[model samples]
Target: MAELQTHYPDVVPDLPDLYEPLVLFYERGGEFVRDNAGFLDLTGVLFRPGTLRGHLGAPSLSTLSDTVLDAVDAEGRISYYTTADGQGPLLRRRELRDEQRDELFSRDLQWEPTDRIPGSKEEAKDAGLVELDEIAAANLIAVILSNTSR
Candidate 1:
């Protein structure tokens, strides 16, 4: 972790207290996007609302699943992860920061919370948000692969 921060100072943020597992999640997500670019392209579901919902089953599930994928896609090397709805935690975090900015402006203050903001790992765990368990991730990947192969 210290090595990553030291070497990739610009890529990795200075969140000293961030949950360790959350960092793993982000790293693993990037690997998945890189490794499965072919499957993602063949499925054509990452950025399409109708196709995403169709592949994932329910609308809410699709939205949540897409949000995670969109986050990874936005920060990944692949250019195909673009989303039309601006979904994902990154967007949500931006929205929260904007709201905080507005509130601070109205109150004539210039302070920002340094701990556990909207998109932090603590908030995610407190909200019971699991970015898909191992079984689910494997199953979804398998489904995409199988469907696209046919």
Candidate 2:
């Protein structure tokens, strides 16, 4: 287990430069960040997309805007957050369109109303479970804190 730096108050324990891994994680949703404690964050620094591209070796790992580090949650993924484009509050435009088309085209089923569900239970459950299968976990590169000692 990687230990936090307690020797000096000012010194943050050794952390790998995981800028890339984090971005990959975000694309899926920050599942790893939730599971692991003391995941080093490069929050204090301001790294532009271009700079990150140079290091992370990807063009679409991030956007031009800075990251919302605090955004990392148990279900960390893009779908968890509200995006500018409303083409999908559910999925991509084509996928969303297909799903919507299915809903529009299919015969509406007579659903039973329950005390717990004042509205459409299936729709509500589907909406709520968006995070369940939406974002996948990314494989982060483990940092070797011991290497820093040498």
Candidate 3:
């Protein structure tokens, strides 16, 4: 783990497309956008499962799946993940940093707590927040088949 951390630039190519895996699920090769059959797949960027966790500290696929699967309701339009509505628009306090950023993702008292639900925004933050190195969605696709051959 330490070795990968030390020599990451050499061993692992930066995956801007794979940055926000939650937004764009990992696939070796496929259409960048596919808003059909339930999933709004913005896939195309992919990394070997082992390499991802080892090199870039991405969550294990299982961990990711567990986190995302349920939150996505049947409609799939809204799926909440770790960190919801941070600090309510960053209220002005002379400086951005002084805007109480750390307490941003605090679970709202209004919402019933489920004792640390798997996909809660808190879990995503607690388990090491992944800063997404990702591509602009518009550049990729306008609704295409994920696996045209399949």
TM-score of each: 0.18, 0.18, 0.18
lDDT of each: 0.34, 0.28, 0.30
Per-residue alpha-carbon lDDT of candidate 2 for residues 97-143, written as tens digits (9 for 90 to 100): 22321111011211121222113435545554222112221100001
Q: Which TM-score value belongs to model 1?
A: 0.18
Clashing pairs counted in every model? 0, 3, 4
Angstrom error of the Cα, residue 22, model 3: value is 12
Model 1 has a clash total of: 0
Off by over 4 Å in 1: 1-119, 122-130
Clashing pairs in 2: 29-76, 29-77, 30-76
For each candidate in turn, give its C-alpha RMSD to the true structure in angstroms: 20.5, 17.4, 17.6
The residue-by-residue lDDT of candidate 3 on 72-115, one tens digit each, is: 21121222222243212111101132331121212221123232
List model 1 lDDT by residue over 31-52, tens digit each: 3331233343212224322454
Cα lDDT for residue 76, candidate 1: 21
